[model samples]
Target: MREVPIRENSIRLGQLLKLADVVQNGSDVKELLASGEVLVNSEVELRRGRQLVRGDRVRVGVEELLVS
Candidate 1:
């Protein structure tokens, strides 16, 4: 797992994906989410607008990211 720092109290899942370099752009988020390849805290998450805070774990494929 790798730590991904955010400048705010919360960040949307879509933005986090891009910030973490999981997706190339915002448009790709929808397709990725629909494919059921994204997970939040080990549960499948399909909402691109889902809010995430510090310590939240997001997994995309084999990459796991920890929000900080």
Candidate 2:
């Protein structure tokens, strides 16, 4: 469990991944999301730009990233 601080609750999900070091680049995050490898709040997330808030829990494969 880790925290990714944000000034606003309108941050994009893909950008959050970068902050959490889940993926190296935008393309990598995009690919992971597109391939149905990213889950948000328990369901698969295909939208890379999905809005994420501080309480949202995002999971990429075996890695779990929490928004803070």
Candidate 3:
């Protein structure tokens, strides 16, 4: 697990994916989400616009990213 710092109260799922380097670009985010490979707080999440706040957990593949 790793901490991903955020400057705002919340961030969009797609943006967070890119910000955390989970994906290379917006297109990658779309594809990854469509494949149901993204998880939020241990549940599958497919919405690119889902709002994420501090302490939220995002898992992609073997990596776990915690918002902070």
How high is the lDDT of residue 49 in model 1?
Answer: 100
Tens digits of lDDT, candidate 1, 12-65: 999999998888998999999999999999999999999999999999999999
Ranking by lDDT: 1, 3, 2
Question: In every candidate, how many clashes are there?
Answer: 0, 0, 0
TM-score of 3: 0.96
Question: How high is the CA lDDT of each candidate model?
Answer: 0.97, 0.86, 0.94
Tens digits of per-residue lDDT, candidate 3, 1-67, equal: 9999999999999999999888899998999999988999999999999999999999999999999
**Higher-lDDT candidate of 1 and 2:** 1
The candidate that wins on lDDT is: 1
Better of 2 and 3 by TM-score: 3
Q: lDDT by residue for model 2 over 1-68, one digit each (tens)?
A: 67778987668988898888888998998788889988999999999889998789998888887788
Model 2 Cα displacement at 36 (Å)? 0.9
Cα lDDT over the full model 3: 0.94
Number of the top candidate by TM-score?
Answer: 1
- Model 3, stretches more than 4 Å misplaced? none
